[model samples]
Target: MIEILKPTELPLARETGALVAGILQTLKARSVVGTNLLDIDRQAQAMIAEAGALSCYVDYAPSFGRGPFGHYICTSVNDAVLHGLPFDYELADGDLLSLDLAVSLGGIVADSAISFVVGDSPQPESVALIDATERALRAAIAAAGPGVHIGDLSHAIGKVLNAAGYEVNTEFGGHGVGSTMHQDPHVSNIGRPGRGYRLRPGLLLALEPWVMADTAKLVTDADGWTLRSATGCRTSHSEHTIAITDDGAEIMTLPKG
Candidate 1:
């Protein structure tokens, strides 16, 4: 289902976006060395409750997942990439961590993700992987605008990841979000330009670009949710929820602080 926000509803969408971004930022700050994944989940839960917002992941029981996520945020570390179920694990220096969050406030939803090193470990590979994803996200956002094809955004993201020598994973890319967590218009990380859905004002899209160091293949963890690289190599993911406008695309999830 593709949900579009009316002009009057844009403010509420922005509010939801701010809440999601703030929580993700807060989680990143506290995810230093020795931070436990469970602790991160708890922190996310508290922040969402304090903001009077609902976590999209908590009740998210998709067929691909084990059940209703039962967690606040996705804590993907090192080899883990997507749907990372929080568990008993403390972060270590040089560990790559990705925090993906989505929340609903005033009945509007926004989603975003960020990947970074846990501590100052001088891990060049981790830094490079994160940089690639970040750049791809920016590239995709830059390509977004009214009348543009969804595949154009995907092409932009693919150009960056492929140029950076990383394989792109399309199994789980970006998607539409509004009034709910996930919606129509599957935005792949790689695609042919001028194909797929066309952009329109009031449309919200979550563009995420993630890559594994060695392979595009993924392996599911025994926990039934966490997605990891097939080769056990490091990975990174970056995402943002953007709104299509008459003139251009507006990023709704930028950190306010």
Candidate 2:
């Protein structure tokens, strides 16, 4: 379903977005070597509860995933890319971890994701992958505003990832968000400009660009939720939720001080 926020609803969306961003930032800071994925999930659960927010992940059972996600956050490590279910695994130095989070507060929802290297061993390839996704995300956001086509945002994002030499996957990409976590106006990572849904004020979109080092193919983990690169190559993902306005897109998920 596509949802457009009322002017009055935008403030709640911003509050929800900030809460999501702050929790993800905190999780990233604590994801050190030897930190277990379950611990990270617990931290997210605690924070969400303290903030009086509801997790969009735990109990989330979409058609694409196995029943009930049963976790507070997604913990993707190294080869893992999207929808990574938290498990009983300890992280290691040099591991590339991606944390994707979404939450609802005051009846509005916001979503975002970040990928980074754990510990001190930041590999060049890992850094490059993360940078490419981040740049793509920025470009996409810059292209978003009232009357802009969804394809324009997709094209902007695709240019960065493609130039970075990584293949783009369209199976899973950005989408609309509002009262619920996911919604209409599916935003692919790559596309032709001047095509697809037209943007409008009060609309919220979650723009994410992710890529695997070598291939566009993905494999599902035994857990039935984690998506990993077919070649086991490192991967990265970056995302943010933004609200379209008359001036331009207003980023909702910024870390709160």
Candidate 3:
């Protein structure tokens, strides 16, 4: 379902977005060599609870995933990209990691994701992949505005990824978010401009652009949730929850001080 937030709902959304961003920033800072994935999830849970917020992932069970995600955050490392279920694994230096988070505060939901390298390895390919996704995410956000179509955002994102020599995957992309986690208006990573749903004030969209290094194909992990690159190449994902306003698109998921 597509949800348009009223002016009053936007404040709650901003709060939720700030919480998601703050948690991600905190996790990014703490995720280093020897950091356990489960520990990261534990930290996220504590932060959410302390803020009196709710996790959108803990009990999330969709058709593509195992029942009850049972995790506070998604910790996708190296080849893993989307729906990364946290498990017993310690991060190693130079491991490409992606943290995707969502939370509900004051009855509104916000979602965001970030990709980074763990520790000091600084692999060039990994950095490039992460940079591409971040650039694509920015391009998509720039394209978002009143009267803009969803495809415009997708096209803007796809161009950046394609130019960076990465293949785009449409299987899973961004979507609408509001009082609930996932909503309608599937925002693909690639599409034609001037098509799909038109943007309007008060609309909230989670625009994500993710790409695998070599191929667009994906393989599901044995856990039935983690999505990995078919070629086992490194991957990256960047996302933000944006709210449409009269001036333009307001990015809600920015790290809070």
Candidate 4:
């Protein structure tokens, strides 16, 4: 469903978005060498409980994933990209880790993700992978505004990723997110500008730009959740929930501090 939140509801969205950002930031800080992915999930659960917010992932059972994810956050490590279900594996230095989070507060939902090196040691490829995704995400956001077509954002995102020498996986990009975590008007990572759905004020979207280091193909792990690079190449994902306004797009998921 394409959900356009009312102006009054936008404030609630900001609250939820900030919460998501804070939790991801906290988890990122705690993620170090030898840190277990499951431990990160536990920390997320605690924070969500403290905020009195609802985790959109814990009970989420999408068609493509195993029923009831039963996790508070997604922990994608190294080659893993999307739908990364937290497990017992410990993070190693220089490991590329991505955290995706979604939550609801005051009946509004927001989603966001961040990718970073797990420890002090950082590989050239890993740094490049994360940089590409972050740059692409910024490009997409800068192109977002009322009356702009969804394709414009896609085109903006694709330009940066392609320039950075990374291929985007369109199977999963961005989408409408408001009352629920995922909604309609699927936003692709590559498309012709001035095409697709036109943006309108009050519309909320989760704009994510993700790319694999060397290949566009993806392989699902035996866990039936984590999506890894088909060639086992490093990958990165950056995302933020934005609201369309009369003037431009307002990023609601920025960190509080």
lDDT score at residue 148, model 1, on the 0-100 scale:
98
- What is candidate 2's local distance difference test score? 0.94
Would you list the clashing residue pairs of candidate 1? none
Off by over 4 Å in 3: none
- Model 1: C-alpha RMSD to truth? 0.7
Per-model C-alpha RMSD: 0.7, 0.7, 0.7, 0.8
- List the global CA lDDT of all models: 0.93, 0.94, 0.94, 0.92
> What is the per-residue lDDT of model 4 for residues 161-232, given as tens digits with 9 covering 90 to 100?
999988878899999987788899899999899999999999999999998989999999998889999999
**Cα distance off (Å), candidate 3, residue 238:** 0.5
Query: Over 4 Å off in model 2, which ranges?
Result: none
Give residue 240's lDDT in candidate 2 (0 to 100).
99
Residue lDDT tens for model 1, 70-170: 99999999999999999999999889999999999988999999998888884889999999999999999989998999999999999999999988877
Query: Model 3, range 63-143, lDDT digits (tens) per residue?
Result: 989869999899999999999999999999999999999999988999999999998888999999999999999999998
Ranking by lDDT: 2, 3, 1, 4
Tens-digit lDDT track for model 2 on 1-257? 88989999998988899899999888888999999999999999999999999999998999989969999999899999999999999999999999999998988999999999999989999999999999999999999999999999999999999999999998999999998988998999999999999999999999999999999999998888999999999999999999999989999999977
- What TM-score would every model get versus the actual structure? 0.99, 0.99, 0.99, 0.98
State the weakest 10-residue window (summed lDDT) of model 3.
7-16
